[model samples]
Target: NNRPHPEYSLKYNKSRENRLIAESSYNHVITFFEGLMNHREIAIPIKHIDFSIGRICVLEVNRDITQSDIHILKTLAKMMYPLMISDKKFLNLETSRFDYVLSDLMNNPKPNMLLMRKKLSNFKFDLDSNMYLLCLCDLDNINSKSKVNYVKQMVQGIFEKHYVFVFDKNIIVLYNNKNSFDYFKKCKEYEEFLEFIKNYTLSVGVSKLFDGISGIRNAYFESLSAINFANRLNCIYSKEPSINFYDDYVLHDLVYDFVAKKKLHYILDSTIINLLADNNTNLISTVKCYLDCGENLNFISDKLGIHYNTLKYRINKLKTKYFIDLKNPDSLVKLKLAIIALEISKGYDLDLGLN
Candidate 1:
């Protein structure tokens, strides 16, 4: 068992010791470089080499460098400075490299259209049927600025292979099948998803999904409508089914155009606001009562427990102020649109005139 001679044993021990020292030094250097690289405020120092040539240079660095190393660094720097000045085109190319990197990241398809369709097939989302797109966004309760990033990450985690886009302040999620709807609706896990979102101040909205890219605009609007409905009703899910934009194209277009152009307040006035405010802004009661009363003076008064004269005065005042005729059927429809638009404008900054 003790076959090694003294010289052999000594050599083995020295070799092992050197190996350990080398490993330790390597690890130390790696750690030092990592720390330096990760330091946010640290920058490589650049020095002017020649004013006439507009040459800039940076020295080669070595830890505990000797005079020879410094001299070599200076020589290298001098050479590099002239090249840098003479080849400004390369510097521009370097700048373009960063732009390319960003573009690649953005377009590299974490989940592209083809991938999304394939993944959705696993979820049994029918490509041929009418679908709905629902987007759920969660806001950060602690740091407001971090909300978008946090929601983006969360959405990415949940919808791993789905395409997501950040439009303004909201995360846009696209869903495209009846199976997808049923799955989300019936899954017990959905409750957990809802809970997780709620913890981060979340909201969910579902849209009527159409067949193509053209339908996407409608789906987006419907999802937003669902969001507005939920907010007004104080409910998590919308009670009504998604509205078909095609079926009601004219009215939808009018409403959308008016809202897009920011002219909704011309059809609703302070009286409507005061009434809504007085009723604790109860959407259903206000809307239903307004419609059921046949825009009649006496009927609304009795239902709302106000004098008939008071109702007439309020109605007349609203008509004059907003220049809207509630008696006409078309104008009445427009009034309803105005109400919905006002509710939708809550979390958004809309220049509705009455506001």
Candidate 2:
């Protein structure tokens, strides 16, 4: 469209006109405008077209408006609508294939690498380089699809090279490895994202950087393990959104495996069994905190919001009644293992019976 005044600019009023187009109720809106210098009248007709994925507006500028012109424009819009809808469906179909193929590859214990490469060739993914896997878990569990798509968009806005998809109701992001994945943790965008989702109660689990396509399944499990540990530790709901790193949980994986193989009652000693059976959760929490704090009295007191005297009293009660010697290396080890075993039992909903 040509303007009567070539030097005149409508940039200042574009936002207001766009708002008018967006908020209008009708399928099409027409507005009359006079040229800046020529004073010639013009008709600007706009038609908002809807597609499966999103909406777009079709606009035309005409010297005069008539029923025939309106019909022609409406007819053109109607003709273009189905093509746009078809394109959207085709795009969605291609995207769903990516989702399905990735899920299948992740689930298969041993996938055919050649076939995998062929399958994903069209997605233009860089499977040859090292990458980091991230899983975003929605605490609410409802609206999984919508939340996944929203998070995917947000992540793409920040990451330039990545493959993002949804699997098992959680959003999975495959970020091409930078010099260090730790860079993402410190980036301003990540902090802003955490702030953005603070109200959504989301937890993020990130895998260590892994090499190539062969390591994807391992990375997937690593991310899931991070999420598992975060939930077991009650970090999901107790604080702001958490971004758990698998490297941080590698040491704990040994204890996790130990508890996974043995029954909690069989693993815990008589003292811990009796302590748990006593039904004083506060005391149990204090003991866990005491062990976690490495027997630092002041730290334990501060962590539990109890006075030093109260903390000492609780420690004495455990020593006298439960015969737990915090000074003894063997006893301390047993106590620490018992705390973890109990947490696994409770957090993972395993058997809690003493028998």
Per-model lDDT:
0.47, 0.66
Residue pairs of candidate 2 with colliding backbone atoms: none
Cand. 1 TM to true fold:
0.38
- The RMSD (Cα, Å) of candidate 1 is 17.2
Report backbone clashes per prediction.
1, 0
Tens-digit per-residue lDDT, 249-330, candidate 1: 3344455555557665555455454443344333334455686668665676788777777666666655675444567787
Q: Report the CA-based lDDT of candidate 1 relative to the real structure.
A: 0.47
Best by TM-score: 2
Question: Compared with the true structure, what per-residue lDDT tens digits does model 2 show for residues 90-188?
Answer: 224224678888988898999999999888888876778878998888664433222345556666675655687777667788888657887776878
Give the C-alpha miss distance for residue 84 in model 2, angstroms: 14
Candidate 1: residue 31 Cα off by (Å): 29
TM-score for all predictions?
0.38, 0.61
Give stretches of model 2 more than 4 Å off.
1-101, 117-130, 142-150, 178-180, 199-201, 228-237, 247-262, 305-310, 328-330, 345-351
